[model samples]
Target: ILEQCYNLMDFEAVAKNTMKKTAWAYYSSGADDEITMRENHSAFHKIWFRPRILVDVEKIDFSTTMLGTKCDIPFYVTATALGKLGNPEGEVVLTRAAKKHNVVQMIPTLASCSFDEIMDAAEGDQVQWMQLYVNKDRAITKKIVQHAESRGCKGLFITVDAPQLGRREKDMRSKFTDVGSSVQNGDSTDNSQGAARAISSFIDPALSWKDIPWFQSITKMPIILKGVQRVEDVIRAIEAGVQGVVLSNHGGRQLDFARSGVEVLAEVMPVLRERNWEDRIEIYIDGGVRRATDIIKALCLGAKGVGIGRPFLYSMSAYGQPGVDRAMQLLKDEMEMNMRLIGCSSVDQLNPTLVDTRGLSMHTTGVPSDTLGLSIYDPLVN
Candidate 1:
């Protein structure tokens, strides 16, 4: 059954069928009208690739370093909380798959398994990063960061986009309505607030630039600000002395109509180059990245790497660890094939000339058609 799934979108269709209604809603829904959610994927189509041919395409290399850590691929798994909603093993399934693939997994603060437990599940020398949803209490935040550092988490990815959870209408509707009958009863904990609100309630809304120094003082881990939507913020993140920035809109889950990460990357790259901060801080992006070609587009626009969230969750939901492993392998296969076709033998050979970005920043009305992602929105079966 798993072999029939050829791409990440196929996994979503299978996961939608396999998961409970509420779980599917929680994983798939974006803020308000989901305009930005659809835009994130559609934005990639606007950029046309200019692949070179007949340039000795043998020996394509996709391996690169993310924040100084060697990764076998150019992309890594972005953090998604409440993994138990998808599978019995939750984040641990991801850990095993990432370890097997030699890619980094950013453990969420609200993971079904505790931080230490996920670390314990890792094999020796498997690099992991911590994604922090800062608590309202400073003491709690301090303890969590310190603990993650002690446990060998290589970097700190601070989620700065969400001070409060956006109104994900599907999750909200699921919370008020009952879809529990169709959901499989796994080992997931029951929450009165449902998946979206339950884990996000403790997030510190007061998080601001002032907190960067406090975080710096607490841990020696490299800091990368996630959810930076503007070039201005990217400049602020660099001046604040952080190691990196993730150009993301929080998977379009927060802030309706916020620009896609790839769009933001296009706006930020030139400024970074002019300021000569390109090498000083690594830039990464997440959202609507389903294809290997999408990764190539972001890389050409100067993203160090890209992050994939929902596809991995869907893969885990449909086939557990093996599903996640297959998903990674598929991406690796695509990257190798695409790179060779683009006449690039290595990830470093990619540049802005490889793509046309004229339509990227233009915003259009209505949700663009995505049959695979839209499959999850069908009325739940009871």
Candidate 2:
């Protein structure tokens, strides 16, 4: 199986076959109908590349920085909940892989491993960001923030989209009950927590723009909003003095018909460039990112980097650390090849002139939902 694996979709197939039913459902399923989830990847098809020829493409470099944290690649392992559900080692396995690869890992607030457990797993001073879901109690939120700063978390990414977890029907149907379902490894999942919603209540819906200042005063970590969806929000994020914004829709698990992150990026970047504020804040997008071509498309359209969640989760769930290792390595190989083929030599060379976004808004609808093919096809794109 390891030798057979090629890309993210291959790992998804392995994960589907290997993961426990409940875990598979939670990791793979999206919101109602999953139109946005599938569209997340399909939206990339809309962008066409205008590859140039005869450039010095022998040595391709995709290394770059995010929020001032330099990484070996232009992507990071984005935050996702519940690692123990698929692997016994939990998020530490991910931490180890991230360290091995020298890319940033955004530790999830709802991780099965304790926050310190994840931080402690890092090799001395590896760049790790904290993905915070604001606790309803300000005191608890403050404590989490201060502790992350103490642990030397380099970036503070406040998730602003999901005030409430969406109705992930597949996860709901697959929720474990009784015996082992009550909890696993004695982590945060306590019955409903184990099932899903118990921790959802811990997140405060009242988190607002006014709260940004409070977050700033508490920690010196660069503050980034992770779910800004519109051009206006990106502008507001710049004005708010945050370090960056991730133009994401929570991997299309929040709203059923929400726009994909890349689509939103097409809308947001022009506004930033128009206002001469592109440099004011680092902009990124996640969701439907599967291939190196997707990464190039994003970079060409002006993203600092991308946040990838499920592919790594799928790889880790199926083959553990080695699976993750190969997944990232495959990306590096493809990134280099794509960069060479596209006639660019470095991360700094990617620009809007290299791609076309005229069809970004032409959302493809009425595509048939193949149940088995859904598992075999890209987990993100139906």
Candidate 3:
């Protein structure tokens, strides 16, 4: 099964069979009914491509810079917690794979491996970023941020969406218990709690817009809000003096019916263009991005890059670092082929004219049959 895996979705199928039920539920489940989870992938189908012919796309350049670092592709690994649950080597496996492929890997706040351990795993000039889950103790948050900066982390991606962990019923049903007290907060050390609740107890629910300035005062690393869903917040993010934003819903794990990041991108791009602030702040998105076409669509609508979380985790779970390396290679091949087919020679050439977004915001009845995402959330089947 591992050798048969070619794409991220194949890895996902293999991972379901390889991983423990509790770990699989924790990684795959979204909030409540998971309507938004399914929507994230299906939303891509709503967008139709307007490919141009007779254009010379013989020499295509898929390389793009993200947060001042150049990546070989337009997609990078997003932060997903508890990597050791997927593989014993944990986030270190991802670090090795990212370095091998010249892509960035965002280290999660709740990673099974320590911050320095993940950093130490990197070889050569590999660029890494830290995903911050703000602690209730501001002093602790400051210390973590400064430490990451000292260790050569490129950016600080602060997760802003989860004021409280959403109701992920699949995890609740599994009754998955967290292994140890991951964070040093004096909170409940009870291991009986589910994965989300146990690890997230240290996160400060009181986090607000006013705290952004304090974060700016702490470290010089670029601050990107990781869970922005509203257009008005993007305006606030620009005014708040942050470097960038990742339009995401915590991979649909935070808010059940929250709009997909791609859908939010569709809404926010026009507003940013109208305000003449589209290029002022770097924009990235993550949620239900499975295919190369999904990444291309995001770039066309003005994303500096796209983040993929679960797929990479699944790949690592099924086949370790080699699985991740293979997944990246497959995406690169797909993007290069699609670039020629779409009549674009480079990432910058992807524009609004290349996509049709008329059906993006419209409500649909059932899950579209074309996507594998819908079945992922169906507990009875998996």
Candidate number achieving the greatest TM-score relative to the actual structure: 3
List, residue by residue over 137-221, the lDDT tens digit for candidate 1: 8898898899999999999999999998898888877872332322221122344545666556677899999999999999999
The C-alpha lDDT values of all candidates are 0.85, 0.84, 0.86
Q: Roughly what TM-score does model 1 have, to 2 decimal places?
A: 0.91
Model 2: lDDT of residue 230: 69
Top-scoring candidate (lDDT):
3
Ten residues in a row with the worst lDDT in model 2? Answer: 365-374
| Superposed Cα deviation of residue 169, candidate 2 (Å) | 0.3
Per model, state how many residue pairs clash.
0, 3, 0
Model 1 ranges with Cα > 4 A deviation: 176-193, 363-382
For candidate 1, the clash count comes to 0
In model 3, the worst 10-residue window by lDDT is 365-374
* Model 3 lDDT, residue 82, Cα: 84
Over 4 Å off in model 2, which ranges? 178-194, 363-382
TM-score ranking, high to low: 3, 2, 1
Query: What is candidate 2's CA lDDT for residue 47?
Result: 92
* Sequence-dependent TM-score of model 3: 0.92
Error of 1 at 350 (Å): 0.8
Itemize residue pairs with steric clashes in candidate 2. Answer: 189-193, 189-194, 190-194
